[model samples]
Target: MIQLKHVLVLVFLCVFSGISQSTNGYELWMPYSNIEDSSLTKKYRDYSKSIYFPGSTETLMIAKNELHTGLRKMLGLASIPTNSNRLENTMIIGTKENLNSDIQQSLSKAYVEIGNEGFIIKTVSIKSKTVLVVTANTDIGILYGVYRLLNLMQQHKNLHNINAVDTPKIKLRMLNHWDNLDRTVERGYAGFSLWNWQKLPEFIDQRYIDYARANASVGINAVSLTNVNANALILTPMYLEKVEALARVFRPYGIKIYLTARFSAPIEIGNLETADPLDPKVQQWWVHKADEIYKLIPDFGGFLVKANSEGQPGPQNYGRNHVDGANMLAKALLPHKGNVIWRAFVYSEHDADDRAKQAYSEFVPYDGKFMENVLVQTKNGAIDFQPREPFHPMFGAMPKTPLMMEFQITQEYLGFSTHLVFLPKLFEEVLDADTFRKEENSTVAKVIDGSLHNQKLTGMAGVANIGTDLNWTGHPFAQANWYGFGRLAWDPYLSSETIADEWLRMTFSNDESFLEPMTRMLIKSRETVVNYMNPLGLHHIFDTGHHYGPGPWVSELSRPEWNPTYYHKADSQGIGFDRTPSGSNATEQYAKPLQELWNDPQTIPEEYLLWFHHLPWDYKLKNGATLWDGIALKYQQGVDEVAGMITTWSIMKPFVSKEQHEEVTMLLEIQLKEAKWWRDACLLYFQTFSKKDVPDGVSKPLYSLEYYKSLKFPFAPGIRPQWD
Candidate 1:
């Protein structure tokens, strides 16, 4: 962390400049600006005067070029190729296959060994002069090594003893971009889609380059570029050329592109009568589609499908199972070494039963029937991304199927782009959840990553929050969510607080004046949002359609599971949804311990109290407060915490970019106002059922429950129409 005085100096620079600017945060974690530390800058300047990549391979060239771009911006020098005369004190980057005779001799001397996605950076005496070697096992490893070196420079780490070696713990670290072809994101809050398909094959956006750079920096190797609610047109020849263009740009960064496949593409694009998986014509159509995709981009990462769910077409329309649908695509892509990622977020309006049990019921019986290349990507929770939810029942139940964990970094169900909610905590809470697969350490993380279940080809995906905004994500602080998602995807065991601290130091300054309170605010931010909006496991209470504000009274939606009132069973005598045996029996979906744990309200954690049971409004909580009072206090506390975040940010005005700081300042104010809006609207609405007072010191609502209910947001972003 940085000292207080250094932080003050940054504040002075911003204040004296008198520049008040607004930035839509589109740059994301790749803010490759100049370095601040003089000593480290000098060290890098001395060490990287020139650089070399040993191979002529395309991936190696990309690694070398990216190093040039990042180092040039950081050191204010145009990087050049190494000259034999300048070989000493220069950075040498290569794979073992392409190293020079002398460098190869040194590498064999046991000073360095490379892992698959790993590299070794070592200082050595060459011809009685100092030289640094960044050697790896493969071209992909060399690219990753470049990113690690850039990160070390960003954090101002010492290069003298920089012998760091690492590889991704998870095999498939990926991002699932919910970007539509028309530039409208599904749950995206950053800006419009970055693809810009209308101009894509003609005009490649520079943002795509930076996007690849950012993803590579975090060890993300795969990207799916369309919304899961896929369009059949994306499979057309025109879009294939656009996708191939993106793949060309990202290939150098070691990222393979993937596209969401519409299940009925054979019917829509191939002019086939039916897309039945069992039909020979439909199967031949898929094989032809796969062949076409490989022709344009041989290294394409295959398809992500959301068939038979949320009205998307799937084989279920023909009375086929998920395994039939998924295996058909897997067989098509298998010849190209590609895999299919089939989403398990299935729900039916026809089945008006408990939403939490629907996915497990649909997926569990078909576990061992899936093809080896098929991955059943399940959301962290059974319901949509709620503020807090227990581990999805499918985590441990599908031992025979490879289950990929999917998390929402876009905050669709949280508060959109306005609230300051750090999502790493939410991620950690889910990863640490135990599935009781014959041992205590059988965490959901292990299950998803194939450690506990011993399945091969593990995968995890983050729903991307990227857009066309200048700052990447709209909220400046929200950049941390993107950063955290990458870090955790690489190694799921990392604590949320640890990721936050690292992001704070790299993105802001290393000063304690900035890090201390700021870290505290980030660590508690997720819980604060939960307290205000969906405390005690009360889920999906946001407004209908766009889901912008409080909507505990929303009960008139078309489907039973579409309304907030469906999740939170708040009535005259009690509050909370009863998912226990007495209610929906959702607890029976888990293992014995979890079943016991969630079935009994007393043993269950207060964080998930309402998620599992319904209790009287006057029932005494574990904290010696009644259920109604406890819920009310949490709401008020969330409001206060957001206010505190604003004050904390105000105090660290010196250590941030003037443009960035002012943007965050305004966002925090927006958060504060909305936090109060959530607290007031929720308390006023829930009170109608509980008939409880606002507790002694809590302020009364500024507006009536009727007025809050009258609120509407027709213009809010991310709400798809029934037909869109």
Candidate 2:
């Protein structure tokens, strides 16, 4: 066995290696850089000298360890614990149950405010002695409190007389991993899957623990381990043992493990004849499966199901509807206190009508029919995840159902992980959208948080951007999107700008010179991608299969809904699919006021102009430019914004490490190239129908339209793995 001294040397070498290449981002906003300000350092170190963090429970142990690590790295304070009976000048951290009886009695009122998961940190006089108390109702809450305490210091906030109480607004803050069993993640641009199935059960990776720390830092309570396009083999006993190992690792961080259940598992794995919900054998198989999983992992969250979407099998494969399919699984997991997140991303064989309207038309009639444990998971937009989409009409319409918001954290349509697109601004936009369901200010945020219709179960799931990349997310700035998603999931009302500021301070530096322009660029990055890729309400114009770049002229595909030309319908007459009464009548699915507002082109928001109506090339925009000229200018503007980003990052070299600055500088160059590619490719294709010259301010296409069309990428990352 290795001696204790040998262990110390090995650990020091590993940490030093990570520290030496600090700009590699392996630490991910937790580098714990030393305080440059002497006053702040002294103040932080003075309070942290005598930490009375008691209790040896797993969660409490991790909290103590994190406190030690943070203090040592941030303030060079190696000796953190002061095991003493006295409370004066000590920072006491524990669950309310473990605290002194007198102190617990005095803090009963504060405990009531924290509920089960919330925590409180207060500096108060105990027996005429000053002590800082960090207490919560449960051990998990204490762990969360400990992370919050460290994060405050990381953000360069002075911790004098700090009194803070926080509780998550959304009950189930979750990540829906699109990872597969074979380690090929669908739409995963960072790297392959994190779960090493070949070496699981006994060999737990340190990345698992670090992943939990990052999630707990921002209060993410749940994660679905497998892909939504799930595999039935995961339900087998061999896989449950591996899953149990992961659950044990995550339990200390207050996270529960969730799995994605394939809809046809009964037939696929159970040797059953059918997977019909009404079949007794199929229902019994699911019940037994849930019981088996629960026995292995008692605190398993539940299953996320993708039924009847994208050629994936579902209850619709039988004659049954979504309600029939979801209720069956919900009943099975009800005894275990687990949930069933039924996806509302479905389409039918009737591809002639609008694909965006199929899900709403199919499920809206069965409102309030689902079991209490069942939540209808809907994506942010009606169509697939686009650069900028209007809030799905399904929200607020199903008043009695618990609708969980599903936002894609992965930059699937926003230029993958290559572009630095901050997604919290996109999430905030959808949350703040007015649904006009009952009265004024019936925002989508209120609907999901249970305040609007008073729902009992609420959740927000982000399609994870995580992978095995060194920084977790592919781009260093892409990590902000993941961080922002968690923060927004914790509190739907948080401003994207505030999230940007905190992320910047923690990830890089606290200097205002770096923070101000960086924050501005981060917030505007989403719109910049939107302008270059799919400007003015255009959606789903990406190329076939890989969806890497533009394919607005793609009309030869077998399925109408699969082709970009189906949505745009560009011709000599006009462009854009008219969703108003004159065409597909898709706008009528929304509430009365939104229906009235979106029907007319003039009354609609200009950003979503082409989403609802088509117009002639000569049509004038509110900016006093022709429709053709406006489209050309918007595309040009997007390319210019990317150039500006490159310039902004060029000057940021002084603030960040050379490696850090150069990495982003290189990515910015790639982003600028792609932005120009999007602009040129789209304008050239659309120009075919408009029969017009490139507008004045827009740059001339470097290649002919045929050359742009000829470009092909057979090996783009993030494509779904093809199976025999």
Candidate 1 lDDT over 124-179, as tens digits, reads 76777677778788888888888778777766677885666666767788899888
679-723 per-residue lDDT for model 2 (tens digits): 999999999999998788899988888988898997788887442
lDDT score for candidate 1 against the true structure: 0.84
Candidate 1, residue 590: Cα displacement in angstroms equals 1.7
Highest-scoring model, lDDT: 2
lDDT for each of the candidates?
Answer: 0.84, 0.89
Candidate 1 structure, TM-score to reference = 0.93
Instruction: Give the C-alpha miss distance for residue 508 in model 1, angstroms.
Output: 2.1
Candidate 1 lowest-lDDT run of ten: 15-24
